[model samples]
Target: MTTTAEPPRSPDPGPVERETVPRPSQDEDPADTFEQRKGTRWLEPRLLLQTAKQVAISGVLGQYNDKRELMGGISPGGYLDLGGAGTRDDDGNLWLDYVSDLGDSFEATYSVAALLSRPTLDLAPQEGEATTTRRGRLLVMGGDECYPAASVDEYENRLIGPYRAALPGKEPDAPFLQAVPGNHDWYDGLTAFMRTFCQRRWIGGWRTRQARSYFATRLSDRWWLWGIDIQFDTYLDEAQLAYFTEIARELQPGDAILLCTAKPSWVAATDEDCEAYATLDFLERTVIRPRGAGVRLALTGDRHHYSRYEAADLAQRITAGGGGAYLSATHHLPTSIQVPPPTSRARSKSPSVRYTQGAVYPTPEDSRRLRWGILRLPFTTPAFAGLLGGIYAVLAVALGAALREPARGLPADLRAVDAALRDAGWARLAGGLADSILALLLGLVVVGGAIAFTQDMGRWRGRTVGLLHGLAHLALAVSVIRLAVTLTAEVLAVPAPWSLALVVLLVFVGGGILAAELVAWYLLLADRARLNVNELFAGQAIPDRRNFLRLRLEPDETLTVFPVGLPRVPRGWERRPDWRAGERERFQPADGQLHPFLIEPPIRIPRTPPATGAATSRTDEAHRMDEAQRMDEAHRMDEALPGGMA
Candidate 1:
């Protein structure tokens, strides 16, 4: 054989001396490159108003748009091949990483992204044993990839920008990325989510593979992973059902599956009749189980915390949504729950499975202690406080206008009534019927809104708590007006026109603090009753206790899940020198950065093969029945909407 001339080899570049490089000052760096200085103020009045409007518009539009149906026209039966070709390790194993609810504050997002971007992680051993795990060849973003809402600009700034900076350059063996849309993602009808995640483009070093929002992928011969998009917790459309039904035809006798959904329906199922859990229960009973495939694990991330529950048979239902969002409360999580729920309309003979809460991040005690931070709402959520202050100011003006005047501007006939009203003490404030009615209407509106905000409890209980809360604010408003009138008129002897300014000032300042305190106390009391707990923490916006999961699939059909927690994300970062030369990542954590630790020991799940003979025969018969039912349903859908399918 003739030997070809080899290309000349370049000289080695040697190890980089990172400490010698001059770093850019904060002022010198571009504005876009810096991490967000603060977390999203969820309690901000303007943001809350904008988000509410978007939710209403999107909810109505999603009913008609149905983007998943459109995806069917492009690729009817498409499923990605994640395990094919160059994805396996030397021992034929596969590694995967899961993260969700990312794209909140920049510091938290970049902190998690930088840690996941590393090629390998040497985790601290549990009991003196050292273990090192490699980065996954696949990255699954479970849900809520961006927060508040989904849009091109929002994705670029809060999500894509940080992830790209974490791993700027593409490698030869870059991992594949896939995502399931959360409720927030559907706020824009999934336009941004589809364009960002479904276009087969690159998010930093990760490559996109799915042609649709929902995806099914084979991790190995014995394992499969399915992610389904249930927009707004609704049922899956017929096209999606058909897509999975076709994939089910290729399933073997004993394949194991990992189901990923946007929300933790099991947790929701514990409280109420969750439609999402009902849909998943139907899909699992009809499509997967009848084919002799067992769903060993279910993963979700909408709750923004890590909580794992296990059944008697060791089946895991995990919620690992703590990518980079506000910390959600875990104290209220149930210790035991039944999937499909007693209220669900499940058709199967074995309707529900009992799952006991196993491990939770931050512990219940810590979650309870964190709620105290909500007491600082006046400081943390100043805009919300200002909104309250503005309302109090209006009520103060109305109350002040209703007070009996000094018998000068009053009509001659009303002097007697004004004198009687003045001597009535607190009752004197209700003298003018028109202004009192206005104040009464405003108070009623506040009370109604507070009642509406208390979602976790029944209507009567919420109304009682809300009535107490509203009355507290009204009492404070009255007290402030009475005090201001005394201080300006009796003490300083100020004029009527100037006294109005003092009344506004005291009410706006004192009312804001006292009103916020009342809300905090109300939330604290209501939390014990499991009411408005989500708002209590969402208002706090705690950026720490972030977490993600790293999983490894072995050749022998065993999967190990490592839950990693970063208790405190680093706020300071330095630019790497190699990044300027177009080689490596740009920013890295500075000195005193905290290290990630395992929230708990690695959870191992082994696949159980299906039985043979009589069991196998029964499974085949059940599979046929399910298939026939699905076919009939699909045919009806086709008849109703002839142009609906591809």
Candidate 2:
């Protein structure tokens, strides 16, 4: 035989590349090493991207309809569908019955230009019926019409594109649209929304040189449309305010005023909470409540949902902002939000209703934005906490004798020496590199904490966000954890702030850096892990059978399967397969009666073929095939089980 050339191979391979084995690097510490975990943000990004591409193609031909021309001049030819109706039926079944039964009717979708040109939906169906008779012509409502750093381009993407994609009418730029600025819309000072939709000057494409972009529209002879820019607080100016007040008076007693604002006022947030806009009360006071004023229902959008509420004494306040914004999850329950008792059309205030059996009630106390500094005060804003902290700092220096009698100058026992500097002359170098400075910083921290002790932390709001910042420093001040670290740095003769501030700053700055890394990691890693809970566990672990069922490698270096099987696992080293690879599994023949499914593969039993004479080749092959099939069956059965399987 001729000699064959071959490449040399290493005696051993790396851990990840190996099959039927798991091992650590010989040079690395096995005790401290672990697999790194990661996560991702968007699901179906590819599918969403395709859908977005389709939208781009469909919208490519749209002329940039300016605020001036859109008032009455824009042309229309949009993909209109007045038939796609979807809602849950009485039995909780989804009902997507198209409106083909009714004549051509575009009930919902409306564009900026279209909204500025139309009037009246199919006459509001007979009394008590939810029948919608949408005329292809009517105004569209724009709520917080922009996205991340809401600029003109973002509006074109977040609002205009989606609006066109979701339209229910037949013509583009004909549905007489009304719009309001959302929090995000004003992200860049409401420039996007103002420049795009409120161009008429006076009131939506009208030439009124008003100070604000708020105005009223006449949708029909019997209908009035009003829009308030929640982001533009200055809109409630004297002239506009007067105009609305007068309009409220002129509105007929039976007229249907389509009231719109960025955020719907009916959500559980109290008036104080909704004070971000400072003007939601306009509907109730000016339009709806005025006696003899023909007040219809109010429509608004903000949180990206279609929520309808019957406010006390008022009609339904509908929040239908889902035209193109990010969809809101079913709004967190009645508790996280609250619906005040409905006011009687004739009365003032109503009582609050308790949660019913199947009702949601997330307590406001437990559910306000829990994000770090979600409720913030400006950095310059002085607060009670700061006031108290400042006082305590003064007290610490002044009342030092009263607070604590610990060793001041209590160093690691001091040693002093003098050194001569050719430039500055002789200087007394302390036992350690400036322990005095560390002591002062530490004292500053101590005083900051003392302030928290005096003030009630339970109550805080926007203006007070800055105050607690000083109080938050208490954790750094007198910390045994921090002191040990800071003292060590100073003794090593590290520079001043570096010895003290660096430690403190590292914890915070490092946390911020880590947070940023985590966010970036989240953006890159998770595919099915964007849910909040998963983010909370980001980088925590790639869980496996070793952790849950208590599987462990014994001190003798043998695999120990604990899962209530051949070997019992140690207390914390539980063995539970996490299905990380979505691997197919097989149940142990013996344990099938007990678990019926396994999250991992069963231990392979090394086997030898029957003696040549003991079985025929045909018989042996047949037997092997049968065993393989049984194993596959077991694998299928195991996959049927869920992760929380016991």
Candidate 3:
């Protein structure tokens, strides 16, 4: 096998749990209250793992759909259209969609939603597959092309970094992609976007005419798409109007027309601008009316949410902007095709509220789809409680047991307590009081963490999340330093190895907690799959609920993501060398019942898992399958579904 180093991926966005055994970092929160510092009651690791595993199922892989069993057309007939969340910028910056997350936080309930989403994030490749098969061609909507200056530096960080992570393994196998600019993408006088994406405009002479107003693109020979790049409140310019007239003249009965612009005007930016009303008017008459003449849909992303709109009198509009920057909350659906002027201030800050927890977006018509978009720092509350509770409980038990037999692990001077307790009844009473104090502290930690879990708030980014994390560490450091100083005084006055150990342990514990918490900021804010094993690994990846032929592979294997449109794996690698075809597990579903099995098939699945960067699932496979005898006898590639089984 040819050996080539995989280009380095983005750095660890933060830290993650990496042990089968419980190994929690200790906390040192002052203002920490006694309870925040000392925790007890613990949830079994196996139970948490079980829950995590289950959520991982549907989360990593998306819900399966055979709807359309065909392609989306460009003509009124159809063409499949897809869009990426935002860009990584020219300089590889990972800018987030903060507005969306800010909006979602207010509505509350992230975990309740996560329960449904966890399973959708862990899907891997099938036995006969090589790349992410279901994904079709990708189209980019506006906003988040880059942040702030829209400089190449920002573009690279936001655009390149994220796209590289998201697209690396799949791009070579999936459909080709193209993008259009949003406000953020156009910041640097449009040069950043133009230079990074379309060095040569798909639209000839686009650069020369860019200042004149509207931009038009010829998708295929017959399909044409257009969008107006204008001020906060303005109509398509005379030039755009003139070009639009030409577009109308050029239109055929079934030509597909896609209209894109940054602001969807949730509530217009201003009362003085007549263009707000005029803009809507333009959409209705210029874009909507032409539907009869063959415009397919209006696609946009500035809204930050995913939505589909079909008015009885107007044309259809589909928005698939949720590609992970941050998420936004949704407002009530519009009452009529043409929105009436709002009489009061709009209450909702965002509009892309509801999300599918267990299912995929653009759901199959028959199966029913759910909408889900993950907001930033989703696990802060629950995780804090769970982590602190588990760790504190174990420590408390160990400490209590240690007191019963004080000399068991004691060093020289510290052992003085052991002899004193054994010698005098008074010392025993003092020991009892200390134990009580310890017990109470433990209880507080447990309860505090539990309370923290449901805190439910914040629309944070990497930088913002980092700031909070830095403070957490600072708080921890302060407490540890104080404890360390007190303990050090004892060390100088009367030396003992146990005293030194105590001081060191306190410092280490505090540091670990700080590090872990700091890393959480990145895992959550930066979207690092490992920093927080669960948040990044589980939350970021949608579960793979339905797929067939799950393949598990190890590193040092021959695999390559071909640079072709419909990506596939090499045939030679189909079967494992040691394991034969007969080794594959088998159990058919009896007459319409559910059947499930783990595929330890002969061939190894290409692609490394997240934790180890080793090909395939880091753990074993588990599946629940329904077969020939199952309900309706309808095949959904159902014959041998290993769909997201890994």
Residues 1-646, model 3: lDDT tens digits: 0011111111221222122222111231111111111111112234355444533442333123211111111111011111111222232211111111100110111111111111112222233433321122223334444432355665544444323212222111122224445544533445565555443222100111121223454433234456555433344544344444544443443344555555554323222222344464455344433332333344455543444444322234444344333222233223222332333233321112111111112233311121122232224234533443344334323333335443544453345442332232333332443465654454444334323322121323333444554444434443443445354444454244444445445545554454344444434444321122223323322321211211111123211111111011111111123432212111111222211121121222121122242221111321122222222222322333332111
Candidate 2 minimal-lDDT segment of 10 residues = 96-105
Question: Looking at model 3, how many pairs of residues clash?
Answer: 105
Off by over 4 Å in 1: 1-37, 125-128, 274-276, 347-350, 406-427, 430-435, 490-495, 577-585, 609-646
Residue 13 of model 2 has an lDDT of 18
Which structure among the candidates has the greatest TM-score? 1
Q: How does each model score on TM-score?
A: 0.85, 0.36, 0.33
Q: Report per-prediction Cα RMSD to one decimal.
A: 8.4, 29.6, 23.6
Please rank every candidate by TM-score, starting with the best.
1, 2, 3
Give the per-residue lDDT of model 1 (tens digit) for 488-546. Answer: 66688765465667767877887887788788888888899888888888989998899
Provide the lowest-lDDT 10-residue window in model 1: 1-10
